[model samples]
Target: MAGSCAPWVGSAYLFLQSTCKAIALPSLYENSQKKPSVFRALKLALADSTGSVNGVDMLKVHCSHPHLIVQLKFCKQENCRHFLRSYREGALREALQNHLQLSLAITAVPLEMELKAGNEHLDSMLKDEDRCLEYIYREKPDRLRDEEITELEERLKGLMIHQSTSNSIPVNDCTSLDSPSLPCPSQGSSLSPQVTFIFQGQQFANRTLTPDDHQKFAKLVSKKWKQVGRSLQKSCRALRDPVIDSLALEYDREGLYEQAYQLLRKFIESEGTKATIARLVAALEENGLISLAEELLGLHSNEDCS
Candidate 1:
């Protein structure tokens, strides 16, 4: 009976050991695969968190220094404190000199409470000084203090005096053509009539037109038309008669008579009344499109009669 029991016990132990090995193998494999990936990610995060300020890795310094300081501050373990102190003091000093500048690196641990509060009063006073400086240099006259106003006024007076002196050209000096006695080209040329067009509130004349003037003017008109069209389209509505009329006028100014006529015709078809037709006719006649204007007028008269 003892021999039989011993053999049975040995077999049971062998079975248990095999089952434990089967269970433990996968977990060990998984841990081996997972641990390296976790370590790599942690390494990447640490690398990214480190910021270079004055060519120093601030995050690494911040992390490592705190750990060392905490060990020194607490000093619970005698061996730990001694090792940390010795390492910090000099063990890697020569190697770390290039990476950490003495003036910029944290040499001592700061009290947590003091660091939290900072120098609030000093910061407040500096902010106040900045505000005062901004007030003195303020562009808005209404915001200026009395002293600032007086200083600015004196500066302006000095500027005006300097300008007056510099601008005073002698009449006898032939080289100084900016004198009052010297006639300006525009004033001199005003004796003769000049062909001029006013487009977008700016005056353009034949004399001022360069060789590429027509192309430049056409490009400008195209740009303006595109801008106006975009604005009208964005409003999600049909273009108004006045906008069409303005565009027609711009096209006419650019010598795009066909485009101008087409725009006017579309305006007339959509929004023209008797008064609008009259205005259109006057505009067309003024722009030397008499035949077109007469045709419009005739159409209007026929409509009115009908």
Candidate 2:
């Protein structure tokens, strides 16, 4: 009877232990079902700690099929926490709908360490447009839509046109030969003073300055000045600091120094300052064309003396 009682007692003790474990252990399936709510709480806790959260750090979006695929990274516990709250609050879905015009589908999938590494590599490559383009062409040529391709092509065309226009040298306008003839005036006369200058390698004889002639000259100078100003502005805007140096070197290489000289002369005449001349000289020197820069400066000095 003692032996039979001992066996029964042992069996009862085992059953009680099993029942306790069943009540104490959490169910993984149930936790998964409540993931959105759990994540939301986690996110709020993280937000409270970090003081701020960025949406980009929480989610990554891509187009895999007709549907948009959103990848959530939880490498950082704070990011994961914030993302959970955002997901629960439906902010993530709303953002996707607004930006990509796509509907959301929530699905739970196993996360792999390798997948996270691959995503990081892809993000780095995308920072460089050429590399990103090459990657797309090699790995996912069909990823981009026809409309997206067309839009990109149009943008490239517009950029090329803008660059060409900005770098182009303005051609001298010789449309009108209807310059008014005015009598040459004495040097001390307040009415009009004689003026002579070389333009496009053509030397204009000394002629009396009248209001009409002054107006015409002023218009011509103002137009050319504006062209130069625009070119400089564009170069600065595009962050092309070496543009002037390149232009000067190209002109010298092509034996078009006379044209370059004439352009500089017009700039000086219009601006009427030594600073413009100094800038031209400095540009040529920076491009390893010190001789050309010196010659240009010499001509400016000779003109001053004359």
Candidate 3:
């Protein structure tokens, strides 16, 4: 499950992985002529899995070109459509290497697809590893204003409390970095953690992005930062949109921004301001990074949103 995510199609055998890679047979015919027939069978299998009859019109997959953007066109239904899923070379390799009877791993594109055609980026990546990485690191833009913390004394005075004991509210004990547990409210307790909220009698944490969140996120992305970074750099050039590019993660090292986690954590932290979790989710969506965003939010998008 580490390398896998929800189907590209809301409903299963599909999101990023071409059911073609589920090429259940390890003895897949290397003969070029036979590949098409196999894909047709795969197309049918995918339709069955997704509960659609004749859904996929075309399923093009090549074992050799594992890095070429993965795509499938389903028989259009109401508004059901298909998309180009770009995978990191690593994910594609894993998909190919997988001989699991019923599983395949795939990575999804984390950028706007309409950028200078998929082929262009592929050609650049295929042609020159040294050449493409010469991107000039732009100035990291800062936009959000930091919220000022009000002193407890000021708040106590503002409330006009004349209690003999200190009126200051104790800080929530939930910010413990040592343990990654979310704030859970104790039942029947008079006081709930400051960060806890009750909804329909169920207590949940009003989680915010924190340094610990950054560390956790960094650990998750650290393994494949290069692949993720490469995709980000290429898309940034195409977007030229100042806002997203500014918040985009840096692949190459720059001071504390040396790792993928640092770059991504910096992105989430908003330069130490009161970081809004929505901002990170919005930025990822704008960049067409549905999978990563979903992962952060602890979800698999079941609704098929075009």
Candidate 4:
């Protein structure tokens, strides 16, 4: 009779357990549906209009969530980090494509704490610096401290002169008649005007000519001059009388001695412009500035003395 009562007691216990589960299941499902997963919450916060918090910071705060903490503790997840990385990269790529019309070549998105690749943002920001000047001035005054402001003023002054340096001036090459004291011929050229900044006695212009740039310019000018000379030589039948005289005088001032001599030798045999050429020869003899005089003579026989 006692053994028969044991079955009834066990059935009653099972019925209570089923009843509790039935009561709890709906609330559990509802809560699961209503609450965002840890990853979703992090993404939503990142998409906030303020653009204040980067994704990595959101993840830090999210670790306090019980579900996420439990998952982290138990889940032997090697690939979990990939989820956040891919999401960040996708978002950055989308922004670049839709807004910037740029395609970054980034395979793995770096953490927010890490430095950016290529410093790509710097170029973008500099392009917009003028448009965003007021914002920067008001919000980021540290960018223009008193010392910085003074430096900017000095740069403006340098730009006003259309500043050229000894390196950039091309010695006596007269292709461009610009000097440190004088304004350049192309005043409105996009590259001519520059603002320089001084830091620790070092100077940097907005667009100073480097050694490579000078070398390239010199090569180009020399090539063009040679081509013109060759064409003139080929049609020597027409290069006589008034044409040759006019050419001689024009280049005598411009300082192309070899060119002038080549042309004058055809007609005069003795170039009456000996005085002009003599000055260049004397300057060259000094050797202190042989290249300068040579370049000057190439433009104007008397340019070295001038």
- lDDT string, candidate 2, 143-180, tens digits: 22345334433443354344334333333243122331
- TM-score ranking, high to low: 3, 2, 1, 4
The 0-to-1 C-alpha lDDT of every candidate, in the order given, reads 0.25, 0.28, 0.32, 0.26
Worst 10 residues of 4 by lDDT: 9-18
Backbone clash count for every predicted candidate, in the order shown: 0, 2, 3, 7
- Candidate 1, residue 148: lDDT: 29
Listed in order, each prediction's TM-score against the native is 0.14, 0.17, 0.29, 0.14
Overall local distance difference test of candidate 2: 0.28
> What's the true lDDT of residue 126 in model 4?
31
**Candidate 4 lDDT, tens digit per residue, 177-205?**
22221222333433232433221122223
After superposition, candidate 4 runs with Cα above 4 Å error: 1-130, 143-306
Off by over 4 Å in 3: 1-206, 215-258, 268-270, 300-306
Q: What lDDT does candidate 1 reach at residue 117? A: 11
- List model 3 lDDT by residue over 183-293, tens digit each: 333344322323443221223344456664465345333334434434443323322334333434444435222465655554443423323333343344333333343
- Cα error, residue 79 of model 4, in Å, equals 49
User: Which candidate achieves the best lDDT against the true structure?
Assistant: 3
Q: lDDT tens string, model 1, 51-90?
A: 1101101111112221211000111122222222222333
Two-way lDDT contest, 1 vs 3, winner = 3
